[model samples]
Target: MPHSIPLIRAAAITPIRRWVEERGEDVGPFLARADLSWVPADDPALPVPLRSVVRLLVEISRAAGPDTPHRIVNGRGGFEIGLIGRAAFRGPTVRDGFARIARMMPAHCTHEIFTVALSGDGLHIRDGWAYDLGDDEALYLVQQYVASLIDMICSVAHPEAPRAERVEMVPHPEAGLNHLRPWLGDRLQPAPLRALDFLVGSDVAAQRFPKGAQERAREANGETGRRIASGASLADQVSALVAVMLPRTTPHLDRVAAAAGISGRTLRRALRQNGTSFSDVVERTRAQIAVDRVRNDTDVSLGSIAADLGYANQATLSRAVRRWTGQTPRSLRSGLKSRIEPGKPVSETRLSK
Candidate 1:
């Protein structure tokens, strides 16, 4: 059985849409090309295909010409201030806000995980996810996400409180680096991982917002979190858990069942009721992760990706990639590279798996 990849909130792409529209570019064709009917303005919580959103970002980049990413970042109007944003905004201090954002990210987007850690004199905010995007798409997403994050922090915190000192992104060509430097500053360092570091000023952690704001935000976030959790089906929960676990090891059905506080039989019954199986979810997740790594993480070798995904070896992953994409691992990588280059027409790049 094959399971469809889960959809993400349409609100995630709101920034890109707004940027394009502000530039006098009609966003309709881009949305249509990404298989989206309309941009959901009324219901920001509405779900849309994640791949489509990725495709839209790539298309927008192509249309906006050189240094498009910088323009998009600078053009960001404001944060949407959803449940997570509200919780962060209501926090007593900038550090507290980062903590709230970290805690609430999983509830908002299951595919990606975020973490905040204190380094010597600064704080590091790391974004981790099983790669499920091509090179260009991944770069666009990371850039957009980091920019929005910094913008949100700056918007809520005191003007001088939380200043980003540096950002680390996956390595790219000189052209990409040139575009990134203006917004990210010359402090940008290309690395094998994705993260952004902020220089926590002395005033950040102790600065407090208006009284009662924290309580109100927390109450609202609690309700939103509960609604999200309650509405999620067992299979959805299992799939999210599997995604988190896949990077470390091949998750077993029994282990996943236990993690969900259900027996194996019960887990199987729940999945069957949801019209899926454990194996189907696992295969789909692995396939998605493999493709992402192959297309984005050019630094990681095939054997390393196979091991990360719990395959026996590179040969096994090669076979799996072929079955999933109707192309070999090498061919898929090559094709994506050719399709993602700057100046390439959007129609040449298909989002379909």
Candidate 2:
């Protein structure tokens, strides 16, 4: 019997698509082969099946060449950080950056974990997965994710900031050195370990960037952290799906269930066991999204916010906000206006009843 397939963030496979397109090869067929033809290629937060992603990589590697994985993750895009990653890569020191990435990654991707550890030798940034996938495909993902981390560090600091003493990944028979050597040089090595590690030097780890704290990145991190802390319950998953689909359309139970790779009845039962319902999840999701947009994004008008959250009109959104936060949308925005004036610390700005 096939074990349950794990859901990963849709952004996880974006680089592969971009790489294939850049090489003049059609990515549609590869996506179809992996049963991902229905996934919206642009939406990064939508959940996708991990098994399908692995199969898609395997098929692409078979056609493109042994170096496909390394070539695709050339560290040019630095997209792995997503919204939360902006704050993660902006930490005081390289060590703090690694620690922040490890903590915040769960909000962007599931069935995978990142760890940062300090040993006598050096600081280690590692990737571990919860799903059982083929070695070659798994190695492909590790290669991409590990390189993206280095790229994220370079994005905030200098290109030569992250000095890796050594890099290690699980050994694969088809893995080639031609492409990896140009990037990692002699530091890339094959090992029996299941995870990939980038062992960094002490000096590089402690090196700090010039730019101080950024308010936008901090707010993004805080919001994502609260969502991830809600746990991986069915309700939380449904809520996340609703949030992603809100701007597009009303995320019905069946549509969300299909995205989750389950039936609506099954999802309903699971949520019931967890003490929640579909309507409850949707309402809560809309309330939170409305508040966040109203409080932080001043450029977006109330009507636009209402439309994005699937509200029928501004009055409906105002009522929902009042019920959720004990304040109308205008009141919440007005409360935050003064705190956002020039020279006011963004950290002092808070939306309250």
TM-score of each: 0.57, 0.59
Candidate 2 per-residue lDDT, tens place, 1-353, comes to 21233566666677778888888878999987876776777676566656677778788877877666656765553444354455455676767877877776776556677788996645788877766566665565555555555644644555573367788876555554445666667887875576777787776777665554344354442234422322356677667656666676556777666655568888777777767667767766666677889987889998998877766788877766676666767778886432222111122111110
Could you tell me which residue pairs clash in candidate 2?
A: none
The all-Cα superposition gives candidate 1 an RMSD in Å to the true structure of 18.6
Instruction: Residues 152-252, candidate 1: write the lDDT tens digits.
Output: 45544554422566666664443556565655567666655554334444455445644455665655522254223312566666666566557744467
> Which pairs, if any, clash in model 1?
none
How far in Å is the alpha carbon of 161 misplaced in model 1? 9.9
Q: Which stretches of candidate 1 lie over 4 Å from their true place?
A: 1-4, 73-78, 160-162, 171-174, 194-223, 226-353
Task: Report lDDT (Cα) of residue 37, candidate 1.
Answer: 45
Clash numbers, per candidate = 0, 0
Candidate 2 TM-score versus the reference: 0.59
